[model samples]
Target: MIPLYLLHITTVEHSESLLWTFLTCNVFVVTAGIVFMYKLFTQKKVRGAGIVFGIAIAINYILIAIFGDPFDLLG
Candidate 1:
């Protein structure tokens, strides 16, 4: 996602494409993190991975907020 965002910064015309890909990647990561948490709490599975994913989710949110959404640049 960071790489795509960097590329998007360099390329002007393909901004939308990069933003879409970046957003998709972010959504996928966030979804996976939620799934991990659910499985960990409900099924008592993915013990170690669940913690890692939870941290990842937090970091992703922070970074996304700091960087700002690429889609916002479109308008």
Candidate 2:
């Protein structure tokens, strides 16, 4: 999904891509993590929740900078 946004950014004729990057990454992380957290909550492995959350956030920001807007989007 993040890659898809990047590809979209490339073909979209110079517009802001950061918004999309942040939106897609965070939304996916939060949504997937919520389900994962709920499932693992039953197992009492609460620590796994923090680790997963951190990983998700880390990856998103990495991708965000890699695929962020090129300043031309402001036009």
Candidate 3:
């Protein structure tokens, strides 16, 4: 996602493509993290990985909200 964002910064066209790619990557990561956390919690196993992933996902969401959506640049 960072690499795509950097590439978008260098190119004037195809910004939408890059934005979609970035957003999709983020959504995939968050979804996977949630699923993993759920499985860990259900299995009664140590949740250290789950907690870390959860925190990372939360931070990602907060940063996106604060920084503004890349799609907004389409207008």
Candidate 4:
């Protein structure tokens, strides 16, 4: 997420293309996380750091979608 923000900042000059870039990144991360979680679940080992990390990422993405960017609201 930090890296995505950094890329967003660096690509400010290309705002038109940034939309697609950001969307693609979001899709990729969420999809990968889901796949990882599913694999872990099926193996009967759904405990530990990987699950926690995936849940955290999923929650963050959900909140962002629900509330809009907190940073954006400040302005």
lDDT of each: 0.59, 0.61, 0.58, 0.54
Superposed by TM-score, candidate 3 places the C-alpha of residue 17 at a distance from the truth, in angstroms, of 0.4
Report the Cα RMSD per candidate.
Answer: 7.7, 7.6, 7.8, 8.9
- In candidate 1, list every pair of residues with a backbone clash: none
lDDT winner among the candidates? 2
Winner by TM-score = 2
| CA lDDT, candidate 1, residue 72 | 33
Instruction: Kindly list the per-residue Cα lDDT of model 4 for residues 50-70, writing each as its tens digit.
Output: 666576566545644443454
For candidate 3, lDDT tens digit of each residue in 1-64? 5765652342334456646754664666667677776877688554666776777666555545
lDDT comparing candidate 1 with the true structure: 0.59
Ten-residue region with minimum lDDT total, candidate 1: 6-15
Question: Global CA lDDT of candidate 2, please?
Answer: 0.61
Winner on lDDT between 1 and 4 is: 1
Model 3 bad stretches (over 4 Å):
1-14, 44-75
- Give the residue spans of candidate 1 off by over 4 A: 1-14, 47-75
Screening candidate 3 with a backbone cut-off below 3 angstroms (N, C-alpha, C), the clashing residue pairs are none
lDDT of 2 at 41: 68
In model 4, what are the clashing residue pairs, if there are any? none
TM-score of each: 0.43, 0.44, 0.41, 0.41
- Could you give the candidate ranking by lDDT, starting with the highest? 2, 1, 3, 4
User: C-alpha displacement of 60 in model 3, angstroms?
Assistant: 11
